[model samples]
Each structure stands twice: as C-alpha cells, then as structure tokens.
Target: MLVLVGLLFPLLGCGGPKEIIVKGKVTYDGQPVDNGQIIFIPKGEGKVSAGPITNGEFNFAAPPGEMEVKITATKELAKAAKDGLPNYVSYIPKKYNDETSLTATVEDKAENTINFDLEK
Candidate 1:
C-alpha cells in the first residue's frame, strides 16, 4: 500500500493545461490602432483568451496551438454618439472578427508576435 500511495502522488498533483504568452500590434491604414479588443479561440478544444488593445498593442497568455484571431476597434464613446444614441462602429472589417480570416500558431519558449494591418 505504501508503494501505491507514492505512485499516485504525482498524478494527484498534476497541474492544468499548458499556456504561452502572445503579443502583437494592430494597425489601420498604416497607422497604429487606438483602442480595441483581441481574442484568440483555439482551433480545437481549448479555452479562449482575450487582451485589450492600448496604443496599438495587446498581449496575453493563451493556450499553445492553432488559434483563430478576432479584432474589434471603434471610435471613442464621446465621438461615437449620434442622434442621442451610442453608435459604436468598428473600424475593422467583419472579415477580421465574425468571419475572421486571421490565424496564428502559438508555441512555447518563442517570440509570439502577431501583428495585423487593417485597411479602411
């Protein structure tokens, strides 16, 4: 029984899923994006991760594998008001979000820099 207990100890203390750090920049029409959110959804079965875009940059830890990327940006809240209603508009095209055409491969111990240059 003592030997059995020792073998089970390692299994019981096993950690959870593996993850890696990812970072990149967002540019629109040749200039850095102002504000937005970036999301990474694993191609297979895995948890999704997100990061906030600030000054055209974003970074976060995510699972290591193939992931579909989605980006969304809009004008400032004060600048988006129209007809007394919040008219949040995205500067990025739908092909980069709902119909994302962006993909990235994340690996361990490597510089994971994924940059996107969008057009208006």
Candidate 2:
C-alpha cells in the first residue's frame, strides 16, 4: 500500500497547474505596431492576461495552455470627427481583433515569445 501511495502522489502532483510567461511582438504590413494592446484569452477555463503594446513589443504572464490571441492597434487621425470626438483608426483587420484566428500554445517555461504578422 505504501508503494502504491508513493506512485499516486507523483501523478497527483503532475496534474497540478503550471505557471507560464507569455511575451510577443506584433507587426502590421511589415511595420511595427505601436500604441495598442494584446490580450490572451484562455481556450477553456483559465484567467485572461492583457498587456500594452509599446514599440511593437508586449510581455505578460499567463497560465500554460491554449490561448486565443487578440491584437488591437489604433492611431489617432489627423483631424477630429464632426462631433468633436477623437478620431482613431485601427491598423489591424477585423479578423485579427474582433474575430481573431490567432492561437498560441503556452507552456511552463521561463519565457515564451510569439510574433504576429497581420494583414489588412
């Protein structure tokens, strides 16, 4: 019984969750995406992590698993709107943000770097 318990203990500990660090860079049309944010949404059940994209770089910590990545970058227009509201434009396509198709597999490691090259 003692030997069986020893084997089961290791199995139980292996099933526990692992921490991971996720980091990445985002580029659009061969240019760096400056001033925006990136979000990592766990596929099933896990916490979500988001970080600011500065100079086309972003880094954050997340759980080890599959994640749906969403990249959003916006730039202020030269002129404001008629209503005086700040006008902004998104460099990335809707598929990369609203309906993202990007998927990343995070693992237990010191650092995971993922880069995204987006299109219109």
Candidate 3:
C-alpha cells in the first residue's frame, strides 16, 4: 500500500495546474503608468487580464509553454482623448491595439517579464 501511495503522489502532482509567473511594468514619458490594463493572450487560448496598474506593476500566471501576450492601456484614456480632454495618458498605437493580434511564446519553466512604454 505504501508503494502504491508513493506512486500516486507523483501522479497527483503532475495533474495540478502548471504555474508560470509573468510579470511586467508599464511606463509613459519616463514615468510609471499609474492606471491601465495589461492583457496576456496565450497562443490559441483565451486572454488573461491584469490590472489598473498598482504602483506601475502587474503580475499574472499561466501554464507553462509557448503563449502569446499583448499589453494595452485602459479605454478610459482613449475615451478621454475622444472627449477632447488634455491629460497625461498613453494611447495604443494603430498597431498592437488588438489583443488577438499580439502573440508571445513562453518556454518550459520560464518567468517572463516584459515592459511597455507608451507613446504620447
């Protein structure tokens, strides 16, 4: 019974969710962005969304192996822009505005960190 239990323990561990930590910071005009949304899109999978930037930092987790990740600022800024308000905000360029359009690959047991600096 002990031998069987020992064998089962390893199997059970294998069944658990793979933990891959993804972390990054967002900045604009040489300063950390205080608010925005960061999105991680895994290759061929749904997106994982993180934050309204807290201290200009964000973190996310996913299963190991190749994944595509895209980051973007919150729509509030864009809306403000449309409203004709002058505020210090970062806007997504014509490119990289679509989450599906951005893709990244993660290798096995990797901690990936990417930083994005938005344009004026």
Candidate 4:
C-alpha cells in the first residue's frame, strides 16, 4: 500500500497546462480603440490566434514560454466617414488599409501588458 501511495504522489505532481496571461490596450489619437483584432504570431511557428477587443482592452492566455509576437489594430469604426463614403474609398495605401503592427516578446511565468498607439 505504501508503494502504491508513492506512485500516486508522482502522478499528482504532474505539470498541468502552462499558460501565460497577456493583456493590453489599444488607442489612437489618445482615444480608446474598439472593435479591432489583435494577432499573435509565435516565433518559428505559423500558429496564430485573434484576440478580441472590448472597450479598448484585450486579454489572452498562451502556452508559457518565450514567444515573439506581433500586434495589430484595425480601424473598423472609421470605415464610413463623411458623405457616407468609406475612409479608404480611393487611393488606399497598403499600410493604411490594415492594422498597424508591433513586435514584442512574452516571458515565461510573466504577465505582459502592453499598449499600442496607432497613427492616423
């Protein structure tokens, strides 16, 4: 019975899912950005996940480790501007057509909170 109990202890010590909490805010012109998508691209891996934006804030959990990530924010609210015309209706530049990108690193057993300020 003692041997069996010792074996059970090792099983209980097994590691569970390792996760890292990532949180951040997005702002443009000093204003909270809403309805934008934040993408995380892991180093050497094509896996990606879209983080949702709520009230200019976002949070996500990823496997605990060092990771190279790129964040982006899209201008969804400014789609339709004056005269019911799309903001990028004509002469849209490649950079302005999508979200702005930033590169950052996530450390192990750490909570990373970052803020991205986009330009108009």
Q: What are the per-model numbers of colliding residue pairs?
A: 0, 0, 2, 0
Q: Report the Cα RMSD per candidate.
A: 2.5, 4.8, 5.3, 5.7
TM-score of 2: 0.79
User: For every model shown, what is its TM-score relative to the native structure?
Assistant: 0.83, 0.79, 0.57, 0.57
- Model 4 alpha-carbon drift over 4 Å, by segment: 1-17, 64-101
Candidate 1 residue lDDT tens string, 38-115: 999999899999999989999899989999999998874665465777767777889889998998888876558888
lDDT of 4 by residue, 1-120 (tens): 999998899789777655578789877667776656666666664345457777789898765444444444445346587778655422222343243245556667579786776555
Residue pairs clashing, model 3: 67-104, 68-104
**lDDT (0-100) at residue 12 of candidate 3?**
75
lDDT of 3 at 19: 58
Give a tens-digit lDDT track for model 2, residues 1-120.
999998898787684456677778888988889999998899999988889999998887888889998889899899998999999988788798799999999876888998988877
TM-score of 1: 0.83
Residue runs of model 1 more than 4 Å from their true location after superposition: 1-4, 77-87
Clashes by residue pair, model 2: none
Best by TM-score: 1
Candidate 2 local lDDT, residue 31: 86
Ranking by TM-score: 1, 2, 4, 3
